[model samples]
Target: MSSLSTRFWIEAAREEIQDWENECSYCKRAKSKSAIQIMAPLPDIRLDMPMRAFAHTAVDYAGPYITIQGCGKRREKRYLCLFTCLTSRAVHLEMAYGLDTSSFLNAFYRFTSRRGVTVKMNSDNGTNFVGIKGTFEETRY
Candidate 1:
């Protein structure tokens, strides 16, 4: 731009640069989101629940992290099923050997056995959670 300025005076140079910037793919990609994000109201479980650690909880799966078992070099992928108390902000981590409903059920049973039955549970509609939901629905009269 400094060298170009010596050749001729650019009228509305700022506007011209902005126009090019707006059209440039790299510039457009680099720009941060301009719209303000509106957060939803906090769920009742977070506010209205009793102070018990596992009274109401939110559930999510973390990852299929690599693990080595036994005295061999055998490695297996395992997921972490995270259970978080809404009001108490307490977290309980459970290892899930697989993403299947049975695996999650085992982990869930372990959690229930230790923490007792939760009054309410929140999830992000994950596939494993969906499968467990269907299982519960089927068992209900």
Candidate 2:
């Protein structure tokens, strides 16, 4: 008693024409909204006086030098240098081994504990500075 074709049955059951529009998969995938519009330019910063006006500091680390005669045979030896101020460019340096978070923090504490507080301090994105996740806490002093 069933004489109707599969296509005729599907078309009758759909009840809407919107489902049959734009059958191309590529066209649908390629189509997207317009690109985002640009806003105003970033603001410029101005300094009233020279860089020396602010207590600025720069920090860097040097060397994992090879073992030397008379020096201990340790693989973690390194030098940490901190330069401060612009006029005199006062610098502080210390020798350390095992560049882990505790060692770095101890060295920094020793330096700052003696030299006193500084207004600004800058250092490159090193493991000692940024620290690894779940290994060390960020210092704020």
Candidate 3:
């Protein structure tokens, strides 16, 4: 075998090499010939809805009950709630000692100053919405 040409040795050993590879436990256990591939899903689109058909608003609270760090007033903490319009996605922000009338008014004024007059405004009805007056018609839930 040592005296044979390299080409001849390779040709002669090909069948034995294939047989050894098939019978070897490590090669059989570690090698794989087939695989499955998966793809991610796509987002859905709604064709019927026109963009910015009506002014949409969403309000959410940003904190739990607590006091201001340095003010030293013994009371519940303040919450920062934001109101956003869905159509234009315009935003209004207010910070309140408690979700009270004054805080809502402050946020409303800030929003109105930036976005101008909106025909409709939307927000969740908490105590902030109670007895509240505004120029824009409100749709509260």
Candidate 4:
């Protein structure tokens, strides 16, 4: 169990323990060993793209930088809405005024107007994104 090959030692220890139950008192315990096995990898689905850029897209929010208004003392936080094409890796960035649904919708509008509607869009599971998910669902129905 103390060997540098932890997996091997673990399997060895497990087998030894199981064998201990069936062994007589006069017999020495057997060591259990594990071997590494190769596994077939899953196919890459991105290769089957529909021959169009931005058809499959991913979105994510970037920042919360503090920025002062034009010649004003007040500071405001800013966020970025990033849109990326899954196939071509083309990227589109839109500034989000805030993390609210309205701000996200505005950014989404700008992106769609420029790049056309996406058949599928992926986003991180952030609360702001979740809010937009509800908005999309509501608009769909």
Residue 100 of model 4, lDDT score: 88
Candidates sorted on lDDT, descending? 1, 4, 3, 2
Please list the C-alpha lDDT of all candidates, in the order they appear: 0.88, 0.57, 0.60, 0.79
Best by lDDT: 1
**lDDT per residue (tens digit) for residues 60-128 in model 1:** 999989999898688999999999989878899999999998999999999999998888889999888
Candidate 4 all-Cα RMSD: 11.2
Cα displacement (Å) at residue 35, model 3? 24
Better of 2 and 3 by TM-score: 2
User: lDDT tens string, model 4, 42-108?
Assistant: 3354455776788888899989978899887989999989998877889999999998888988999
In angstroms, the error of model 4 at 4 is 32
- List the candidates' TM-scores in order: 0.67, 0.46, 0.43, 0.61
| Model 3 C-alpha lDDT per residue in residues 1-141, reported as the tens digit of each score | 344454464665667666887999888777856777796653222122334532445666677657646577656677787776665455566665566677767766666566554455445566667448552337442
Residue 62 in candidate 3, Cα distance off native in Å: 3.4
Question: Candidate 4 — worst ten consecutive residues by lDDT sum?
Answer: 24-33
Q: Report lDDT (Cα) of residue 109, candidate 2.
A: 66
C-alpha positional error of residue 77 in candidate 1 after TM-score superposition, expressed in Å: 0.5
By TM-score: ranked, best first: 1, 4, 2, 3
Collision count of model 4:
1
lDDT of 2 by residue, 38-132 (tens): 97753222222244432555667776754454555544445554544433467777666556767676776677677665565566778877774
Which ranges in model 2 have alpha carbons more than 4 Å from their true place?
1-54, 66-76, 132-141
